[model samples]
Target: MLNSNMLRKLDMQDLMVFVAVYEQSSVTEVSEALCVSQSTVSYCLKKLRTSFENELFVNTRSGMLPTSKATAMYPHILSILKIINTCHSGIPAFDPTQKEITFNVCAPEYFELLILPKLVKRFIGSRFPVIINITKFHRDIPADELMEGRFDLVICFGPNFHRGVKGLRSQVLLEDELVCVVDKNFTLAEEAFSLETFVACQHVFPTPWTSDTNMIDGWLARQGYNRQIVARANSYVAALNMIAGTDFILTLPRRIQALTCDENTFSHRRPPAGLPNFTLDMMWSEKPSQDSANSWFREQIIKVCAEDGLL
Candidate 1:
């Protein structure tokens, strides 16, 4: 149902007109905002309606109410406008005080739970409102998609880097070691726990969000060992909660344990030998990585993480 002729009929200016009308809810307002005549705004709106074969807006007591179809199109239109603005010829001047920004990032739930709260708290009274959308980390996403600006940033373990990573920019954010967390009431509280004890005890494992791959499981498999997985949870919080008043123990990043678990309720110890420390990295496509806005946000993230001793 798609053809070049039909595509030619759809104009970027008309999409802009539709976005303005949707936001301002009046043709006169759109005209004044764009420094165009009322008639021109109406003409653009008419073209948009025809191209989409829908009455995009309807007049109601509340002003111009977008129809269901127009409402669905609203976000996509705004996204296109943002892409255009970002891809402008020169280095785009970023005025944080004047423009609000939504940053798209991806990370595992473990990292999200540990980092996002602190990161968001730092921006509470910032001049610009920064909205962060954190999606699950997908290690398999193609390099071309990232280069095409599909995601503004990604944070995950350094080992997660793939062939596509060669084309992206990355920086080490933090180095974290694995730690074993057990309820304070654990019977082994006074004893030195070894690798054999760790594998024998009931283990609580939190599954990865993006893939079926479980790092704990994979590591055990590589060592020709397996933990007694008494419980499996989709999130680190749930896994941590399940350890209380039980024989189960959790093995996870030390940072998460320090941030989420109460010291009095839980006892922490360094992981048994053979477990290696992991480095978390901040990755972004080269094209937008150097942009002023992206650079500013990256700095903000770095600052917060450092304050928490996560760096």
Candidate 2:
């Protein structure tokens, strides 16, 4: 337990260093990120350790690893910094045109193909001078990552966004159903695309994004049906190549198929009936203090989606 005197010794700079070192796990990197000298960062870390009575971090072969105490203190320290940042800058009205700003967004390749082009065009036309940093979406949106200010917005599939995460909000941007792409010469055995024909065809599954155990397989399992996946490709381009002149079927999102497939080489058909549609969502953390910048940025994304007929 820190007393008043110990608390007084700890300043905002010390807290910032503590958080940075914990995140980056390197004093030099923390110094560079904070725009302070290594000695200054060391001094701040020393003060933090003295105040908290914990080493907080331990140097190891891999990197500077946070100690148990440091891990426990991380969330609370991050919350304090967020509150201070909100108090310091929350009152100022955010005008995107007036100043340069950067927003970090996390999304999958699907967003890059469908939404990012229009979003960038809108910003370029408006001359907002804002930088948009895009990172790849992972399996799940961790609450702490958003709360830590790492990502300003996250666009993901409905199943990828967990609703149980507190302090986070989400809105559905668009909905899309799956479509089956096959070589132009490929023929459906039945009059219409039936489940029997669908399962009989050799499938080329996209790796990392979907697999035999994905929603398609899950749905098939419910109906006591399964498809034969003969190959896996890391990308749609590779999958298309694999499907060229071959009777391999690739099931993917309708929007993605429109973007990746060539009409001359491939044709897309409606997937079998009872296939589930997935929603694309934009999620963000709700801070104790709200900023209009986030609101403005979110509206821009929504506007792009609506104009693209994706909404």
Candidate 3:
């Protein structure tokens, strides 16, 4: 049995390592799960042995087997640890006005233009330090980077694969509808956009990392018609700029159209009919975060969305 001194001397983190290795039957597996080095796991195991007065595990032909003494200690030890962990599940509040922590936000260009600016002003006025990394939204994800805490939060399209990292938190950001855009001075042959106009007009299709250009191609394939692509880009901003000067048309989200059209600047701007809508989501690795700070930031985002009629 592990006495009070044994428990006191053994850090809970080391015990967790020991428990994970015990259950997994391998140090390599536990090291990967905990995102730590194999040497660190081995070191923790040695400490556990010294505290427990026995080899907690013995390598057998089948697997690393936990000793009888170690088996006896599992139940009460795991229960107490679980209770301690449950108490920490709550996400904390963050008062940006006073904090000086650097937060990293990952997103596609759309969020950078439509979402980041407003959030940055709030951050600066509140004195919170931050950095934004703009990467193509369609790149193959690096799952280990997420486990290693590369990004504080991701502003992305719905669906992510890195949910096993223990502290993941996700929220649906908003449902954005698509719109048709053209230069204010440009004129279509018809006053109202029709299916025939959509099919015949020279089109500017933007490729944002996910092979969306290909998806769009597929969507239009069955129709026996497709847009003539005059230009393409992985960035939405580029597409927006190109559409501002030509007779060609581009599809954009309503929020973007809302920001881009200042009746004075784009008097003829309008979204065409028959495009689909999609949702954007906000996600974070929630586990290692300080609880109060998490709660505060998340609520602020939600509050801002509601105030702006963005939800």
Instruction: Report lDDT (CA) for all predictions.
Output: 0.79, 0.83, 0.67
Candidate 2 has its poorest 10 consecutive residues by lDDT at 206-215
Identify the runs in model 2 with alpha carbons over 4 angstroms from their true place: 1-92, 159-163, 189-192, 208-213
The weakest ten consecutive residues by lDDT in model 1 span: 158-167
Evaluate residue 115 in candidate 3 and report its C-alpha lDDT on the 0 to 100 scale. 70
Model 3, runs deviating above 4 Å:
1-99, 130-136, 159-169, 189-192, 207-215, 222-224, 233-237, 262-274, 286-296
What TM-score would every model get versus the actual structure? 0.65, 0.65, 0.59
The CA lDDT at 151 in model 3 is 62
After aligning candidate 1 to the native by TM-score, how far in Å is the CA of 282 from where it should be? 1.0
lDDT, candidate 1, 243-308, per-residue tens: 998878898787788877888888877667777677888888888877888888888888987887
- Model 1, stretches more than 4 Å misplaced? 1-93, 139-145, 160-164, 190-192
Worst 10 residues of 3 by lDDT: 158-167
Error of 2 at 258 (Å): 2.1
User: Model 3 clash tally?
Assistant: 11
Clashing pairs in 1: none
